[model samples]
Target: MIRAVAFDIGETLVCDDRHWSSWADWLGVPRHTLSALVGAMVAQGRDNAEAIRLLRPGIDLAAEYEAREIAGRGERLEESDLYPDVRPALTALHDLGLRVLVAGNQTVRAAQLLRELNLPAEAIATSGEWRTAKPAPAFFARVVELSGVAPHQIVYVGDHPANDIIPAKAAGMHAALIRRGPWGYLWADDPVGAAADWRIDSLAELPALLEQHRGEAG
Candidate 1:
């Protein structure tokens, strides 16, 4: 049985692409152009705003970026308001007697966002407390230890491949990828290509997906 179901917060349970789009607007660049540039900078381990500040003279772009992110908190509260179906889905999982947890790389700001969005804190398992982030085996290991579940008994779902699915799988957990966002090229948009054990587009689908593995040979 899938004893525990874990999730990633950013872009998986919460939406962040809108924040990026808002940031692009703040930078006064075409959405697609900004998206591409941001992707490149993130790929190169560079700061998108710093890169913009260096090249785009006289633009106190960092403040704009901060404003966009602050707006993301509001948006997460407004838009990511826990999809209409998410509550029922999670309730169903609870009904089935499976433990639910959130395991993700979240900044301190994100914790505030989750609160603003009214995401339940009961099941949350985060890396911020440990100063670690996903794609790091230590993060996944920490999640395992915190949840008190053996790796094979847990099912991890997230929108990022390398950060969530890949490491979870390596840690002996079944992983599912939820495709979201254009930032952090953790996985291609193509869910199948991500090679996750499973994929779903929305959190509403999670209960059924987890049920599928209850009797399967993992």
Candidate 2:
């Protein structure tokens, strides 16, 4: 029985385009330049951080990421930052008596962002807080721990096939791939994504999916 739902924040609940574009503006680069680099890296099945290093050789990636996070904090995320379907889906799940958690490979401020946005989640867990990032099994384990549910009883929904779906399934959680974010539409046909228990175009479909799961579990 699925008793919990854990969502990934970046590109899952919130589109990260604004954050990336803001970083580009702050760094004095054309928005498309940053977009192109990250897109090229994703296309080649490479890490986006590789593009950051390629654009400015010898730049400190961690320090730069942190700097970007700090600058964005001056004007934190708002409800407008979330996907339209996010609150609806999260609310529906909670109303169904399921625990809902929002987890992400993000700075600690991400938790604060969700809190400020009034997202419908029991808890917000960040990679920074856990000190482990996704695509790592331990990260999923921590998600399971925070959810207060066993892996098999949790459903993890996200956009990244490599970072979200694959690892969640490996950790024994059902994976749902939503085809909206950077990797989502591109990876729809990926073997790992296809292997997911559910693949939908939007979180608008999530409530029905949860009902179906509950039906079978019942």
Candidate 3:
């Protein structure tokens, strides 16, 4: 039985339109250009940051991020950025007596913004804070550490199969592939998504699904 549910940030809990748009503006390119490049990279199973590198070769992403922050165009997260189902789903999970955590491949500032939103979660964390990113065993190990539970007692939910579902399962947790974001939709029907123990279209569906799992377990 799953005792906790952990979530990814982008495309799983929040929409990334503002993120990419801000980058496009920073690079002085049309949003569509950067968006297209990102889509192409996703389709080709390449790193999304490769899109930025392709646009301006040898660009130091870390420096650019600091520059953007200095320019007051850094990562921003508002309640409006959250999907409509987020609050209701998280609340429902909490009501079901499950610990809910938000741990994703996001910046430390993004983690701060999420806390400001006052979402119903036990804790919120990011790859930037941990200095570890997903698809890496160390990242999931950190997650297991943060969860304060055995890996098998946790459910990792996200839109990315390679980063979230596949790796989470390999780490001994159940994985839920949520089909909402670009990565989610694109990979939903792919064989790789089959690795997810659960495939859901909305967070609102999670409470019921997990309850069903509980029933089956009992």
Candidate 4:
């Protein structure tokens, strides 16, 4: 039986329009230009950061991030950034007595902002804090360490199949593919996406699905 649920942040729990828009603004490009590049990268199965690199060739992203922070135009997360179903869905999981966690490829400041939102989660972590990113076995190993349960007892949910579903499954965790974001919808019908233990259109669908899992396990 699943004892815990961990969620990805971008386009899973949080809508990332503002995040990319900010980057476009910082790079002095039209928001739509950056947005189009992101979509193109997603379509090509390339890293999303490639879009930004394409905008500013040979740019050092980390240094640029520090510069943006110093300029007071760095990462910002607000309650409005969260998807409508996030609070209620997470609350329902918490009410079911499951350990709810938020872990994704985000920055330390993003983690702090998420905690400030006071979502119904036992813990919130990021790639920056762990110094690891998804699609990597070590990242999922860290996730297992954080969950404090057998990997099979935890269900990892995300909108990215390559990063979230495949790696989580390889790590022995049940994977839930959420079909919402660009990558989510674009690859929803792919065979790799079909490998997920569950495919959900919304987080609100999760509680009942987990209940069914419990019933089957019984």
Candidate 5:
């Protein structure tokens, strides 16, 4: 039985792409510039410190981005109310007796993101706090341990296949890919190209999909 359901924040539960895009536009850089900065740092063998240094040009921009992101977050629910099915979908999973938690890449800002969205403070498990990011087995393992559930007993739903699906499965969890419409993890694997046990175009489809799994398990 599925005893718990873990989610990836950002693109999964709440949406922050608009804030990011606006930041990118304001900074006069490509939307993927931040992503490229991280990648360049890794490629140059500088680790996280170097990545931050490279992005120093936009230090002031960071505050503006954060302010807008936090202020505008959760203003309308999921992704500006564009995807109105999020709350209902989460409600259905909750009704199924599954423990819910969000594992996001925000590190220290994860909690802030949840708060901006008016999400319960306890629902988040962020990578920033742990000093690690997703797609790494250790990151997902931390959530499993925190949840007090075996990996196989949980379902991890995300919009990124690599960050969410592959690693979740590697940790022995069921994986589902949410078709994120332009509001996804910019630094992670593509949702469509990455492997997953199942893929759905909307959160509205999640309940029935889980029921199918329950049926099969039974």
Candidate 6:
């Protein structure tokens, strides 16, 4: 049976387009430019922050994150920031006695924002805090460690075919592909997605997925 459920925060639980647009404004580039940079970064198989560093050599990422965290602390995240299916799905999973957690490639400030949202996660962590990002085995390993279960007993859900699904599977965790975001739809047809344990359009579909998997495993 699946004992734990882990998620990628961006585009999975929360829509990150607004944050990317804000980054565009901060970088003094048109929002479309930032959006293009994101697509380019994904197309080239590069990390977003690394792409920014290469694209704009003088931008201070750390300082920008600090400013975001400061503003985030004072602001309350609205329900609109979350996917419509998130709360109900999380509640269903939690009531099913599964552990829920987030392992995301976000800034320290992002973690702070997550806490303020009162999500059903037992723990929410970011690469900035873990000092490693997804696609790195260490990040998935850490998630398994946090889950307190064997890798095979965990289901890791995310939008990125390469970063989230494939790597989680590589680490021996069952992977779920949620097709709702840039990476999700962008990477949908990748051969890697074919290896996912589940391909779902909404979090609302997850509870039944768990039941189906459990029955098959049983």
Best by lDDT: 4
lDDT of 2 at 82: 88
In terms of TM-score, how similar is model 6 to the real structure?
0.90
lDDT of 1 by residue, 18-105 (tens): 6566655666777777767766765664545554654466776446546666766333345444445556666777777888777677
Clashes of each: 0, 0, 0, 0, 1, 0
TM for candidate 2 is 0.94
In model 3, the runs with Cα more than 4 Å from the true position are: none
lDDT of 6 by residue, 41-105 (tens): 87777777765676589879777677765876322356788988998999899988899998888
Q: Which candidate should be chosen as best, given TM-score against the real structure? A: 4
Model 3: what TM-score?
Answer: 0.98
- RMSD (CA, angstroms), candidate 6: 2.3
* lDDT ranking of the models: 4, 3, 2, 6, 1, 5
- Superposed on all Cα atoms, the candidates' RMSDs to the truth, in angstroms, are 4.7, 1.7, 0.7, 0.6, 5.8, 2.3
Off by over 4 Å in 1: 25-32, 39-85, 183-194
lDDT (10s digit) by residue, model 5, range 45-158: 344335344655446544654665676642222336334666677778777767877786764754554556654323677887888888788898898987788988888888
Clashing pairs in 3: none
Error of 6 at 132 (Å): 1.5
List the candidates' TM-scores in order.
Answer: 0.72, 0.94, 0.98, 0.99, 0.70, 0.90
Model 3 scores what on Cα lDDT?
0.94
Tens digits of per-residue lDDT for model 3 on 12-125?
999999999999999999999999999999999888999999999999999999999998988899999999999999999999999999999999889999999999999999
Weakest 10 consecutive residues, lDDT, candidate 6?
68-77
Q: Report the C-alpha displacement of residue 83, candidate 3, in angstroms.
A: 0.7
